[model samples]
Structure formats: C-alpha cells, structure tokens
Target: MSASAAAAETPAATPAREPILSVNNIEVVYDDVILVLRGVSLDVPEGDIVTLLGPNGAGKTTTLKAISGLLRTENGEVTRGEVRFMGENIANMAPEQIVRRGIFQVMEGRRIVEDMTVIENLRLGAYTRKDGAAAVKRDLEMVLDYFPRLRERTGLAGYLSGGEQQMLAIGRAMMARPKLILLDEPSMGLAPLLVKEVFHIVRKLNKELGMTTLLVEQNAKMALGAASYGYIMESGKVVMDGTQADLLDNEDVKEFYLGGGGEHRKSFKNLKSYKRRKRWI
Candidate 1:
C-alpha cells in the first residue's frame, strides 16, 4: 500500500475533554422499596450533546432526576453511587442547590405554570441566578430570538399549544444559563415538523452557546441525530454506548429504535445466532 493510503487508514488521535456532568454507577430507589435505576453510568462532555435513549420504563427520566437532585422531592433517593457536576459531588444536594450549580432539567412534560403568563414563566427560570436586571433582560431577549414564536405569547401558559409549551420549557431552561442541561423527552408530543424544529434548536444551542446537554428521549432516531455520543438503556442498565456512527450502523439499534429496514432472519437458528451477535444489548 502507498504511504499516503496507509496514513489515511491510520485513525487520528482525539484529545479528551472533561465531563461537565457525570453519573457513575448510580442506583435510584423510590419510596425506600421500589428500585428504579440499576448501576447506571454515563458522561456528558463539555460542549457536546450526549443522548440517553431507551424504552418507556428504562429509567431514563429517573437518571435525570437523580442527577438534578429532584429525586428527593418524590420520595426517591440515590441509594448507591455518585452524581458529580463540575467536579463536585451533587448526589445529596437539594434541587434548588443543584439548579444554582449550573445544571437544570427540562422535565418530560412541558411543566409550565398554567396560571402564569409566558414571560412570567421564563423569568421564573432565572430565580437561581444572582444577575442584575440588565443581564436577565439580555438573556430573555436571546431566548425570544431563538424561539421567535414565543415573542408574542404573553398570555397564560395554559393558552399555548403543545408544541409552543415545549418550546417554552426549553427557553425557560436556557434562561438559567445552565452549563449542563438535562433535557428529557423534548420531542414527546409534537408533530413531526415540530420535533425537527426542536432538535434543530437543540443543535443550535450546543453549537452557538457552547452548551453541554444530556438528552433523554424515547425518539432514538431524532436523539441520535443531534447527539455526538449515544447510550442505550434497558431494564435500568446501560446495555450499549458508542458514538453516533457506531450506533447508527448497529443493526439492533436500527431494528429496535430506528425501525427495521431489511429482511428478517430466515430461521429460528438464524435469529438465535443474531441475538448472540448483538452483544451490545
């Protein structure tokens, strides 16, 4: 082989960036008896979007709650392991303390205050910040620019559409200027086009604001598209983790998450053989 061809075949070395958020070997239990997360571990590198993808009951939401210190609110607790953010152990901290530490979670449903106006809802997100009115005003302007549709909706949050509420949830999270955003189910109930638009904004935030995100989504295909790294969870465990290319090329991920695209195995033996081959699960 030619020297140039050999050099091309050799992979380039990558420099490692520090994790903004780390959930290591965590086990979350609720009401002291019901265990939800089992030895879950994942990392969100600075300035990159890392997605946590799984089925409905795979403990994705629980993991986010555990990291953000919201678990304690619902009689949930991190029974084992540690959740560290910006190099500090935050597993035992309160939710408000966690928010003050630059990590905010946009909850699965658009949990805006129904009685409050849209701008009032956005201002609530900055409750943790010690910034002056000028800084808060600037951040509000930035969020409005990102979600132009929100520019006019000063009415009550209950009056907004489902898609608009999702947008408001994200914009509210951004108002905190969080270093790491735990985004849960951003594409939950929106139309296909709206999902596309939300993911577009997600990518834009990462690229423009230098934001780091840990996204939890059942929409694996859409999540993977926005993510640089992906983790697949099942039955409260991380069964597989890899880069976007690694995940997108996996036949199991394609069949299960992205929807199958090719012919099925011909026999039970073939199926059994392929199951064995799917070591990632």
Candidate 2:
C-alpha cells in the first residue's frame, strides 16, 4: 500500500469542546447580606437536558437569575465566579445583551401577559430581532406547529387553558432562536395531565429541535426522568451531582427526595437508631 493510502486510513483524534453554557463557582447574595447561592456550578452542552432538583429555598431560581443578569435588582451579585457562554464571560453583560447572545429564560409562573393576545405576546418575544422577517414568520409557524392549541387560540391568550398558557410561554422563548433556554419550574401549579403535556413539549424541544436546556424543577421524579444529568441542591449548595439513574437509585436520594415506600422510611429510622446506639457504646 502507498504511504498516502496508509495515512488516509488512520483516524485523527480530537479533544471534546467545552460546554455551551458554564456557570463556574457562582455565588449570589440578595439584600447585600442574605446569601442565596454558594459557589453553584453547572454545565449545559448543546442538545442536552440538565435539571436542577431541589426543595424550596434551594437557590435554584436565584441561579437562573444570575445567569440572565436579572439578580441585580434584588441586590444579588455574582460576587465570585463568572458565567461563560460560547467561551465568553457574560456575568457583566446587560440582560438584553444576554438575550441577544442566545440565552433566554422562561421564568417561573409562565409569566405570559394575561391581557395580551397570543400573537401580541409572541411578537413581544421577537422584539429584539431586526431582520429576517420571513425567517421569523416561518419560525412562528413552526412554534404553532409544535403547539397547535396556541395556533387555534392565536387571537386570544386570556381565555386559553393552563396548558395552553405554558405552551405559549415556551413558544415565545423559541421565537428568539435561543441556543440555551433556562426553564424555571415549568410544571409548577399545573394539573398532573397538564404537567405531563408540558414535560412532553420540553422533551420534544430538546430532542427534536436540538435546544439545550437548564431546568429548575421542584418535582424531583419528573425532572430526573426527563434530564440527561441532574444536580441536587440543598440550602444553596449542591449536595449531589450524578446521572439520572444513579440519583434515582441512591438510598439517601430515594429517602429524602423521591419519597420511596414506607419500608425505606423505616430503614432510615433503623439506621439512625443503630448509629445512636453505636455512639452511646
């Protein structure tokens, strides 16, 4: 064989690229004294679902705000580390600039304009865009295609169902063509059926549309099931970080977060008793 043919048969190895979004050692403080996040770090690669799981007051929401530059009003500051997007530090960028940089946040509560028409609300999402009218129109149609209920009610948002409102919120975020979307409790305050629908849409967006997501959810089981990887936070600190299956099978996680069977609770109590007896001895 010729040397050129031999060289052509050899494969070239390349190092993996960094994640699209990186939150490195971020600490947030509100009111100048009330600290919310303590060195929270997370990474979201392209086309993956990363969930932040925690009970209330775990600094999940605050982490999202820090990434979007919306923490300043609450007197919260990064204070320590930086948030990097596409290899650029965005900790000091303005919120508008952050959106332009392809990071969009769908805040808690769905936050859709109650009185505006569905189209109006969607239009507001694209206010940042200047060109590509035809492309924007095509994207809007595509969003409606994913959310057909929104298309049926495109003339009215105030009268839509809870599920429709959630759909609109997500569709609105899509209008901006974001590279990574920060979703804060998309299933909160929804019926079980509606929650399933919302999660289905989230999964579809991540899998079918190739959108990277950072999800903060109180519903631990559902979040872990949908996520590629998960971080469990407690009192502003990450207590565990692992694959979904690892976290699901963890004894401590099942006892505390998953609310496993009564047998699991009894086992925890027995373990505690054993520890106490050993200490006494």
Candidate 3:
C-alpha cells in the first residue's frame, strides 16, 4: 500500500485521560497481623464512576479505608504500594488530611450522628473547608436541594427513615465539595425502590456535578448499571475488571451475580463452591 493510503487506514490514537484517583498494587494489614487486601489496583478517572464488587470479606471496604486513610484508625495499614490522588501519594495520610485533599468517604453504614440535627450532620462534612460560613451555608442549601426530605428532618437525624438517612449521608458528602467520593455500599439495607432512587441520585450527581466516585457494593446489578467501569474482587484480590457492558454481558457474572444462570445451574447451595471459585481464581 502507498504510505499515505496506509496512514489513512490506521486508526487514530485516542489520548488517555489521567485518573483522578489511582490505587496501585496495595496491601493492607490489620493490628500488625491479619493481611487483608492483596495487591488491589484500580483507577477512577475524573468525573467517572467506578465500582468494586464482591461477596462479604472481599476487602472492598478495606480498599476504601486504604484510599481514604481510615485504615490507621482501625490499626490497619497499607504495607505496600501507593494511593495517588491528583498525582500526589496519599497512602497512610491522616483521614482528615485526605479529606482536605478533596477526597471524602461515605462509610458503609449511614454514619450520620444520631444525636445531631440533620443540618448539623451535613455541616460537619465541611469542617475541613477554609471557605467562610457563607460558602458553607450555600452548600448546605445545595444539599437540601438534592435531598429535600432532609429539610423536614430538622430534628435529630436518628428519626429519619433508612432511605432518608442514606440520602443524608450522601448530602453530607456533597457538603464537602470533594473532587472524589469513596462510597461503601450506598444501597445496603434499602428496599428495591430506594435502591433505584439512590442510584438515580448517584448518576445525577456524577452527570450534573461532574463528581467522581469509587463505589464498593454487593448489588452487582445496580452497581454495574451506575458505573462505567467495574472490578470484581474475591478473597482480597481483584479477579475481574472491565467496562459495564463487559461485566453485565459476561456469562459467569450473569449466572452468579444477576441471577440468570443456565438451566443446568441450580441453587448456589447445590453447587460446589470450588466450581465457582475456579472461574475467578
């Protein structure tokens, strides 16, 4: 082929965008023993939603703690590798320091203070902001706009419904004006409808506000629906990583996670666990 013709036939290279958050081959240990996460690595590009999914004890939450620097509080430490946010290594930094650096974690449970009023709980998220009360107050109004139910819940946060409490937790994270959010099971314990609503809000925040998120979730269906990219973990290690469509369309994922197994596959209890383990391991 002619040089010009050959050049024209070649595909153009798509420039790679730098990730807002990068976790590289990190290992975590608890209490100077009990190794947890094993070389888990992933990336969250700016304004993108990524999800980490697995069964219980897959180290999903531990990964979040490792990135958010909460591991130290639990006597857990990132023994190897690095976590970088905006190109700066933040692994093992103080939780407060990580928050100030524009990363906020909405922990697994709705960790809102039951004793405080809903508004007070939201304000607590902005403790690291140097901006004056005016900016904080504006953000407070913005949060209420996102979760209008919080407006009526001026009383103690303890009284809100489970879904409402979940909303409060996210709204509180919004109060931080963070660059990235680490969400650990936002849909946990919610009804189906509430799960739908929460995912809708999550999508809205990502699309409208350009918020970047790294989500750890057990609801594979919902997580895959909301996230552009996904990682599936098993026993503290990432076993699979792919785009949403890739995971949703995968035979193993459809069978195991989405409840669409073949006729030959019966209930999980009837199956040898090793049969499933072999697929990922």
RMSD to the native, candidate 3?
7.7
> 1-281 in candidate 3: lDDT tens per residue?
22223223222222276888999999999999899998999988888888898888989999999999999999999999999899999999999999999999999988889999999999998899999999999999998998887898778999888899999999999999999999999998999899889988997898789888999999888888777788999889999998776776777787777676465756657566757666553
In candidate 1, where is summed lDDT lowest over 10 consecutive residues? 6-15
The TM-score-based order of candidates, best leading, equals 1, 3, 2
lDDT of each: 0.85, 0.80, 0.86
What is the model-wide C-alpha lDDT for candidate 3?
Answer: 0.86
After TM-score superposition, the amount by which residue 82's alpha carbon in candidate 2 deviates from its true location, in angstroms, is 1.0
| lDDT tens digits by residue: candidate 2, 98-165 | 99999999989888998899888887788787767897898888988998878778556878887788
- Show model 2 residue runs off by greater than 4 Å: 1-17, 261-264, 267-281
Residue 66, model 2, lDDT: 92
Root-mean-square deviation of every model: 5.6, 9.1, 7.7
Ranking by lDDT: 3, 1, 2
Measured by lDDT, the strongest candidate is 3
